[model samples]
Target: MMMFSWRRRRATRRMARGGGGGSMTELTIPSHFLCPISLDLMKDPVTMSTGITYDRANIETWIEGGNFSCPFTNQPLHTIDSIPNHNIRKMIQAWCVENRAHGIERIPTPRVPASPVQVREILDKIAAAAGREDCEECKSMVEKIKILVQESERNKKCIIANGTGNVLSSAFEAFSKPERFEKRVEILEEILSTMAMIFPLQEEAIKHLKSEASMQALVWFVRGEDKSRRRSSILVLKEIISSYPEKVSELGEIQGVLEGVMKLIKEPICSSSKKASLFITYHAIASSSNQEGFTKAFLQMGLVSLLLETLIDAERSVCERALGVFDGICETKQGREEAYAHALTMPVIVKKILRVSDLATELSVSIVWKLVKHESREDEDEEDGGVKVEALQVGAFQKLLLLLQVGCSEWTKEKATELLKLLNNLHRERLECIDSLDFKDLKRTF
Candidate 1:
């Protein structure tokens, strides 16, 4: 009798637990139900199991009214399909029994609250310590703060360092800022002295002096009326040019400043040592190819005649550089006519070019190359009424061709190639000059 009552209690419990497949076999039923669609939980619950389990009249009405679905499948359950005897309900019940008879376990939800009060209190403590300044923690923090600020400032200043800290740029800017001339001059003198001292030690120091700012200062100083500063500036400028041949523009200005420096070189008022220094300065100014000032300076100082005289006694290096400057002067149309006139009247100039060794030969060839390029430009302009080619003298080309034929050095060949290319473009008439000679062969031979 007790066993029968227990079975009845189990059945009652199964009926009380709504919408899930009940365990008829177990006294303790499973906790979860299966959805009709997924055969899992009743995700969207419905009532289409058994007539005794759900409201059969209402479910039948809902299914007929198009509202009822299978609890496991969530599929529309028609009255014909879900009226307990429907074959589809039997299949869903079997699926729910197999898949989810073990039931769905309830999971507890976790809760987390904000900690604003604790965070604010910690921040306030830190702020109070910082404000006290006497706090031991604050002292270390302040040191870190100082370092960060200094680093930021350094980063800001580093941007201008390349331009403002540059010796030449500062010197040039000083020229326009006359109010700062005294300070600039002092810096210039320091830089010049450093340049001179470091030149023999490192070639790069000479390059720094050749920058536009340094060149501008040297040009201004050369033309300035102050004889003492001119003398000093020229001395330093010469030292720079002597070490670095690339700064040839200074030679142009040297011609204008020549007389003053020459006076210093010749005067008994200066010691022999000082005179020699001045002469070296004069030599530096005279040797540059790019500077027109050097030509004017040369003429002003009567250096053309002096250069001719020195051809006999001049050191090989000096002779080579001086001739290079002369060649540079002669390569342009104006320079060519001037040099040709000088060379024609003064056989010494021609002799100097003809008798010069390999170094001098290289310089002479470069000069010829310039002349060739200049002539070619003139030829082009003549076609456009820009200039008259016939107006140009013819002797230069004849001399250049003769030099190319006889010259065998690699430098000569390179210069010849450059000149040939220019001539080929402008004067096809001169192509025969390079037709027989292989530039590669000459390069190999040299």
Candidate 2:
């Protein structure tokens, strides 16, 4: 019993030393068994009987006991008072000593390579098997090849560049052959899916490929004999807007794509697809100033109402993007009036503005002020033409008053006051419309 106690004390001292009296020590473990908390050897490496080792409880305890966090996950340690498995602890100690002796601070685990040889072999197999003409089998093989190429690319190697480029070029070349366009489309789809995964890892290489192969694929798919292929191309173009915005912008003639996307939005066959296409088109338009023609096309397509509908999309990102487009359109005088006219029929616009809380409220209030000021200027010019003052209704003024009353931030309130002064200057008759509200109540609310 004394000998066992002494061994335990020695183990505790070893652990304390590795922990550096609560500071972290760089102790290396097998890449698979490293404890995230200490970035060192794990204690009582809890392997299931099946050889899967993970000690969630031990990890949590170590983290909590020392106020430590996992380096990868950043999760807080919550508890660490129980004894670990003795055999596993011994194994971990032995392994740590072995690694330390070899000066192995961090052993990188083996990862699957994304290489040209692997891609070339997969392409050769596909080419040889072309006589079978089994679409499902072809798709399966293409998907497997794509996955392998993606995995290799993710391993931080440039092995797939030559192979991938050749494969894509051959696939595009095959598109003009009899019964090969469908096969080419399948190959392009696989390549696109793989590119989506590997692009972040090999961005520069992927960008070049996207500008070349992806562009060719998109053009072919869009102009294909098959309607399904055309639709698929549209979907892929939308994906490019997100993954390769810079490259997509370089393609030029975005108006044609915007028109195509807008037409699809009006079709009931693919409502969600249409919405996604429009969302991407809007982003593409917002990304470039030269594409104001696309923006004008959006306005011509009754996009104001569609955009308003999108503000309440189930996807927060979609809603944010739609709002951003709306804000972008309202930046100019003509666009502001166009937006203001649309806002009059949509009460949700005001409700959405209110829901924006302080930050959004401040911005919306400022936008409203600018719109009202512009309208006032227009109203002044119309008076000389015998336009009746009473006939004109400034819809934004009442909303601004309500916004001022409910606004919570000091900045919002001060801006609101400035807006009211501007409105009085534009439509002096409208001053009584807001003065009826208790100024004291507005101040208290703020």
Candidate 3:
């Protein structure tokens, strides 16, 4: 009496009509058309050497998961490759066409992925064309690669894995030289545009490009008339410095690299370029062998002014980086003096405390500590006087207390506590000096 078989059943479907009404359609599917692994209609079905057919996606997933046995048969696989099961795919396509009324949309034919051989061949052709002074052919092949990499993540990875990164690095090494930059501007632009998309570059690919000469070439591109190339060059420079932090000193040694990088910080083209410029500025100070000289150079380039402007308005990440770089600069005596001299410096610094991020707050406190540590703390007029007085007048005292009360990183708390104590001491000294003064003995005219 209770014999219900679930194996064979006619499913009912309710589809939404164009005007939001409901329509019923029943589609009977052939089970052979379903992938055994997914148990769904197979699109781009392919047959394994095991004689089992599956959707190519399912086969790929199974192979990638380290499984060698057929899912249904548990038989060991002799080959990892699968051939396209065109007949099954055609049948599935036909089934979808027959059920078009049930919202069954046709699956477009799959594109053939870019093979590794094709990428290598194209690069080879480009190199040959360039050697022959065939500019048009060379540019065409580079454009093809740009298109290939844009097709899919798999294609991009394949291109990089096949040594596309080193090829680009080599191109930069050859074209980035000032002697070649003019005649080669078009190809340089094309290559730079292509290289921008390939990020997280391998060190071996870029290790040769880290020299002072290469950096100068990069600066040329940064200072190039083509504004777009300038941004692209900055992005590449950022990727390089980030990868080889130890070599940041090499960049500092370059005659004009600092100003070029600072220009980007001053006039940001985009968020990524600005962010990259900030990072380069940070490492230039942080990783330099001669921190004193490097930081001094940064200060003299009006870095303090740029950083103040950034802290005044840059977003959270940019603000944090600028603060950190400022902190580094303030480590040197010249840097501290420059920051202390600016009218808006201490006030803007005070404004950033606890508003941006923990790291930012920490950097702000550290900078304030450096600026105040050696200031002539002797008594002075608050109207136009001592560093401590200006800090207090700018509401630094109240912000310090709030930072301590709200809590912060241990390092930040330590700096904040010390600065707070110093400001409090200044207040105390002023009060005691007034009390000890002989002004009380004089007559009040008012």
How many clashes show up per model?
21, 5, 0
Candidate 1 has a TM-score of: 0.33
Q: RMSD for each model, in Å, please?
A: 31.4, 13.7, 10.0
The list of candidate 2 runs beyond 4 A from truth reads 1-141, 145-183, 193-202, 219-249, 252-255, 263-279, 287-291, 312-315, 340-346, 356-370, 376-418, 424-446
lDDT of 3 by residue, 274-337 (tens): 8888888888787648788778788878988888888887899889888888888877778778
Report the Cα lDDT for residue 428, model 1.
Answer: 40
Deviation of model 3 at 244, angstroms: 3.6
Per-candidate local distance difference test: 0.44, 0.50, 0.76
If both were scored by lDDT, which would come out higher, candidate 1 or candidate 3?
3
Choose 1 or 2, whichever is better by lDDT: 2
Worst 10 residues of 2 by lDDT: 385-394
Q: Summing lDDT over every window of 10 consecutive residues in candidate 3, give the lowest-scoring window.
A: 1-10
- Of candidates 2 and 1, the better by TM-score: 2
Candidate 1: tens digits of C-alpha lDDT, residues 21-110: 555654332223333233332222334444322323334444556565654356544454332323334444554456453452332111
Candidate number achieving the greatest lDDT relative to the actual structure: 3
The TM-scores, one per candidate, come to 0.33, 0.49, 0.74
